[model samples]
Target chain A: MHIYVTDHNGKEHELEALEGWRVMEVIRDWGLPIKAECGGACACATCHVFVDPDWQDKLHAASDEEEDMLDMVPDVEDNSRLSCQILMSEELDGLKVSLAPSAKPDAEVA
Target chain B: MSEQEIVTDVVIIGAGPVGLFAVFELGLLDIKCHLIDILDKPGGQCAELYPEKPIYDIPAFPEISGQELTDNLLKQAEPFGPTYHYNRMVNELEKQDKGDYLVKTDAGETFRCKVVVIAAGGGSFQPKRPPVPNIEDYENTSVFYAVRKMDDFRDHDIVIVGGGDSALDWTLNLAPLAKSLTLVHRRDSFRAHTDSVNKMRALVEEGKINFELGQIASLEGENGQISAVNIKNADGEKSLPATRLMPFFGLTMKLGPVANWGLNLHENLIEVDTEKFATSEEGIFAIGDINYYPGKLKLILSGFHEAALMAQAAKKIIHPDEKVVFQYTTSSTKLQKKLGVK
Candidate 1:
C-alpha cells in the first residue's frame, strides 16, 4: 500500500507500506522522526499525527486512553491520532499523515 | 545445580532517570532495589544519547545536560540503598511459583525481586540507515547513532546526516567545537525548531558550517576511521572530507530480549494498566519510555509521576499486610502543600 507522510517541515514522501503495520512503524521504518516513545502502544503521544480528512473514516476510533493522551499533547486537533494506533491496510492505501511538533522544549544544558 | 537465588525487595530494569526515581521511591518505603542496565554507567539512554546536550524541561532546574541529570539521578538513587549492575542487559525474566520474579542478564547474573520495572528508553531503538553502500563498515569506529561524549569530536572534521532536531541541534551545538562541520539532509527544509534552524543558517551563512541538502550516495572509510563522505546533492554528486560521520537519522525501537516474556505489547511498547502502570502479567510493571498507558504524558516529569504511582502500587502488592502510608519528604511535602494536594 502507499502511505504519504508529511513531516514537520511540511514535506511529503510517498512510500510503500505493508498491510498490518502500524502507522508509526511505517514512518519509523521509512526513517521519519515520529518518536513513538511508547512504540505505538497508545502509551506516549509522541507519535501523534494528523490523518488526512478523507481517509479518517478508515481508522478505528481513538480509545479513551488515547483521548486522554491527546489532551496532553500540544497542538492537538480533531484529526490528531497516535500513529501507533492506526494500522495500515488495503483500505488505507492512500493514508496521509503529518508529523506533529515534538513537545520536548528547548535545550537547557550548555 | 539449582542454586538458591538471592532475592531483593525490588528489581529495576534500567538505571536511567526514571529507574533512579524508582530507587528513590522504593527507598522512601525502606525497600531495597537492584538496578541493572547495559551501559557501563548509570542514566541509561540519557547518558548514552546527547549526554552533552542541555535539557530544559526537567522540573526545578531550568536546564541541565544529560550527564548532569544522570549524575544527579545517580546520587539520588544511591542515597536510597540501590545497588547498580552496570554494563549488563536483562536477558530474561521468569516468575517463580511463590509470586516473585527472577531476572537474568546477558552477563549470566541473576536476581530475585518482588517487582520489575522496565525503564529502557529509546536506547533499544538502534539507528536506521538509508540504503547507502559502504556504511556498514564504520558502524562503531566512525558512523554512530549516538553521541557518547562531545569532547571526543573536538578539533575534528565531522559530517552529520539527518534533517530533524537531533541532527540540526547537534550541528548547531558542535559547530563551534569541531574544526569543520558539514550537515547533509535528504530534503531542503529541516524538522528542527525555528530558532535552531535560524541559528544554524546564520552559522552556515558566516562560513562556520556547511549545509548540504541531499542524500548520502556512499560512505568511505578504513581502519577504524572515516575519511570522507560522498553525497548526491541538488548540484550533483559531491564528496566531502571528514573524520567522523554522525547519523542522527533517527531511532528504531526494538523490544530486545524482553520481547520473549509474552507481555501484551503494542508494536515495540508494552501495554500497561492506566492507573497503576502494571502490565498484563500480575507482578510485572512498566514505566518510562517503554511503557504504554492510555492518556499518559511522556516526559521526564510525567515519568516521575508514573514511577511514584507504580512504586506505591507495587509496594502495596508486595506487602499486602502493611498500610501504605506516603510520608512525603520535606521537599515533597512542601511542593504538595504549594500545589494544594492536601
Candidate 2:
C-alpha cells in the first residue's frame, strides 16, 4: 500500500506503507517533517493532519479518545484527524492527507 | 529572589522515571542528590502526557499506568531522602572555578554540584502556540497563555478558547470580573471536570457569558492590542470583541535551554557513551530518552542500567580517593541498610 502526504509547505510525498500500520508511521518512516512525539499512542496532538475532504468518508469516525486528543491541536480544521488513528488498508491505498502546521517539527518552525 | 546556594553531591536535571531511579542508585553509594523539574510534580512525560495510560513494557509489571509507575519509582527512591525542586527549569549550566558545576534556573535558584545528570526526557514540555497568523504580535499584551493577575483582565472583554479545565476554570473564575466574557471552543462539549462544566453551563444560562462553537480564525488589532477575534463555525464567520484572549491548547515537548549548554547533540538528543552514559563533558551524564548511543533501545530498563553505571562513575568523581565497591541490593547488608530494609 501507499499513502500520499503533503508537507506544511504543500510538497507532496508518496510513501510506501504496510497494511495495518498507522498512517503516521508511514509518513514518519519515510523521513517526513512530522513531530509524532508520542509515537502513535494518540497521547499527543503532534501528529495532527488534514484529511482530504474526498477521503474523509472512507475513513472511520474519530474515537472519543482521539477526539479528546484533537482538542490539543490549536489549528485544527473541519477535515482534521490524527494520522496515528488512521490505519492503512487495501481499501484505501492512496489516502491523501496534508500535514497541519501544528504537526510540523518545532525546529523547523522558523 | 536570590537565596543561599544549595550544595549537593549530584544535581539531576529531570524528575522523570529515569531521573527518580538515579536518586536510588546514587543514594546506595552514599551520594545525595537534588532533582529539578519544570513541572509542578514528578513523573515528567509520564505524569503530564499519559497519566492513566497503561504501559506494557515496564519489566515486571505486565501493564502499569504512567502515574502508577511514577508513584512506585518515587517510593523506591524515598529512602534516599533526595530533595525535589519542582516548577523550575534549568536555564544556565556552567562549570565553577572550584571544579564544581553551577546550575541556574528560570526561578532564580542557584546550586553547586559535583555531578550533573541530564536525565531530561524529550527536553521540556512547553505550551503549544496556535498557528494564528501574526499571533506573535499580540502576545503578552492582548493575548495571554496564562493569567498572571486577575486585575489585568478586569474591565476587558475577555475571550477564552479551548474546552479543557484551564479554559472552563478560567471562564468561571474571571466571568465575575470581566465586562464581557466569551468562551470559544471547536465543539459544544467540554473535557473539563463535571463540576466546572456544570458551573460554566450555569453561567451560560444566566446570560453572564457567551459560548461560541468555533476555532479562532484570526485576530484583529494593532500595536499588540487586540480589538476582536474572528472565528469560523457551522453558521458562518463571527467576530467577538476581545480585549484579552487566552488559548489553552495543551503542551508539546521541545529541546529547550539544554541546547545552549555547549554539549554534543545528535538530532536534539544528547550524545553519551554506552559504558558510563557520560556526555562530552566530564562530571556530566545523560540518560533516558534524552541520550543517544549506537543501538540505543530507549527502553526504561536500558535507562535503569545506565543509571547504575553512571552512579559508579559519579561516585568516583565526587570522591576520587575512595575505592569503589560493587554490591547488589539483594544480598549486601550495607546496600539493604541504605534502602532502609535493614
lDDT per residue as tens, model 2, B1-342: 235798899999999999999999999999999999988899988899889999999899999999999999999999999999998899999998767999999998899999999999888887788888898898889899888899999999999999999999999999999999999999988888999999999999999999999999999999999999999998999999999999999888888999999999999999999989999999999999999999987777888999999999999999899987888899999999888894
TM-score of the candidate numbered 1? 0.53
Per-residue lDDT value at B338 in model 2: 86
lDDT of 2 by residue, A7-47 (tens): 97889998999999999988888999889887778888899
lDDT tens digits, residues B214-313, model 1? Answer: 6677777787688888888557899999888887644333457877898998756789986888899988888887788777556788778888888888
Looking at candidate 2, what is the lDDT of residue B93?
98
Q: List the residue pairs that clash in candidate 1.
A: A69-B295, A109-B54, B125-B252
